[model samples]
Target: INHQTWYIKAEWRGIDLVPRMLELFEGHHEYPVTEKVRIDVLRRFGYYSTESNGHLSEYVAWYRKRPEEIARWIDTGSWINGETGGYLRVCTEGRNWFETEFPQWLAEAPKSFAASERSGEHGSYIIEGLETGRIYRGHFNVINGSTITNLPPDAVVEVPGYVDRNGLNIPRVGDLPLGCAAVCNQSISVQRLAVHAAVTGDDRLLRQAFLMDPLVGAVCTPPEIWQMVDEMLVAGEAWLPQYADAIAAAKARLAQGKAIPTRTGYAGAARLHTKTIDEMRADRVNSQRNAEATDKAKLRPAAAKKAG
Candidate 1:
């Protein structure tokens, strides 16, 4: 897929099975860390105006609207500085710094991982039956509409699986907690509509997808959602050959009327200015580390010590 489409993966993995995994493995879990990750992701991804445009602001607004609920989700013990299994700076207060500075470091000082045997980040998957019929237990990201049992059959899902000579086998999770399933289903609805819209170039369905999106729907009026979809399609028209006829129609509609009033230059609520190269140079070691690190949010002991 093109770089234009990479943001889908970057943005869509919200409120995943980490909570469920915690419940299964550890017997109980709170959602503070998960909630922090969600909020930080919104702030981080929202800062990319080229990727998210105005949608980031909508997400921030939605979170802000539910301050009491979000506060309730917070668990102090789940917080961390330089440790795994908890919230680090990048997962919390320093999210903007990581989001803003890390990309700049990557673009300016590219690092090659080709020679590395191990990296700070890796996905969890189980390999089975290489020598014996041993089933190493871990989670695998796979298409899971049927396995999940609660979500739509067409939805992509991540579930626990094992890879054997027969290839990967996914087991039914039975049902997620009702609230979790409900949340997943809502997002899946938008995703399903989006896939159909992209394949068929049905602009109406595309608009419906945007309308059905949780944050967008919560924050934007119907007229605003309609107009936003039109603008997004027109802005992305070059990469959307399937939407040729739809693009023309959108162009005509956009041309015929004055747009609804919107905050033209509104930065997201939690946005931070990207660090300049000169400013980064002042902290050369940190900048260099950021440049080389595959996990941009990996805990930094020195930085954490300084912060303390």
Candidate 2:
């Protein structure tokens, strides 16, 4: 009876039990055996497919059976005979593994791993108290525990907690500098103009200051005054001081009149600098023509060589 039971167990192991156990072991335990080595391994090759149980399991099994064939496919353009064509290629290039057979699954795992690693690297701000101004600035890992080594105990602080989409905790600090409101209000006009100039990259704010309001232009709108000075220098004006005096006179004339002057300040100076807008446009055209002529002169030798 004992002999019969031993024979029965041996037969069961030989039949389906051994193969099934091997498959299960390979799928879960065997491949992930060395935690230290597996981390570095998965960091390179990534992980296996979590989708399509029977088909994926079979695909993994086939690769495991013939390691040499997979290596050949990587080195030379070779294929393995499987459900997928012999065209399936697998190899590690640089830090990535290229697999043609299970391309989709293999590609997805590494990208997911990289994204997770990137998220781990990004730093988050921490806020401590609502009424006080205490805070911490550093990074923390979700997988491992965090250490809070740095802190300023005497500082007033505000701490607001929030979680991101990846379930990462983020802290917000709510604290304003002293006398911020009064300073902002006092400098609002120039601040708005500077912000507009920064956003638009248009020199109109400078132009407005120099042409419409020289007092404001000289102080708040210095950019326009400097621009006019540059133009005057370019136009071969003998004395900038004289031109500045002329601009000041124009500003005074506009200020005397309640209605905004049709022509004033830097507008008059610009008119004097270029004579007229039509003349300025003509000069620009002439300058472009001169540049083109100079380029053509340089290219003549190249054109002659091509012709020859």
Model 1, 216-283: lDDT tens per residue?
Answer: 77768899998998898899989999999988988999998788877787643433344565676688
Regions of model 2 farther than 4 Å from truth: 1-163, 166-178, 181-192, 198-201, 206-308
lDDT of 2 at 90: 16
For residues 1-308, what per-residue lDDT tens digits would candidate 2 score against the true structure? Answer: 00000000113635744224334434663233312222222233333222222122122222223433432212111111111221121111101211222354455655334534433222322323222334433433222111111212222222223433434354432222223222222233344554564355334553442433312332334544554534433354343343454445445544564432223433211011212334433565433332323121111110111343
Q: Looking at model 2, report the run of 10 residues with the lowest lDDT sum.
A: 1-10
Q: Which lDDT values do the candidates have, in the order given?
A: 0.53, 0.30
Error of 1 at 181 (Å): 0.9
lDDT of 2 at 166: 36
Give the CA lDDT, 0 to 100, for residue 38 in model 2: 23
Best by lDDT: 1
The weakest ten consecutive residues by lDDT in model 1 span 1-10
**Model 1 off-target regions past 4 Å?**
1-117, 120-135, 164-166, 300-308
TM-score of each: 0.61, 0.17
Model 2 collision count: 9
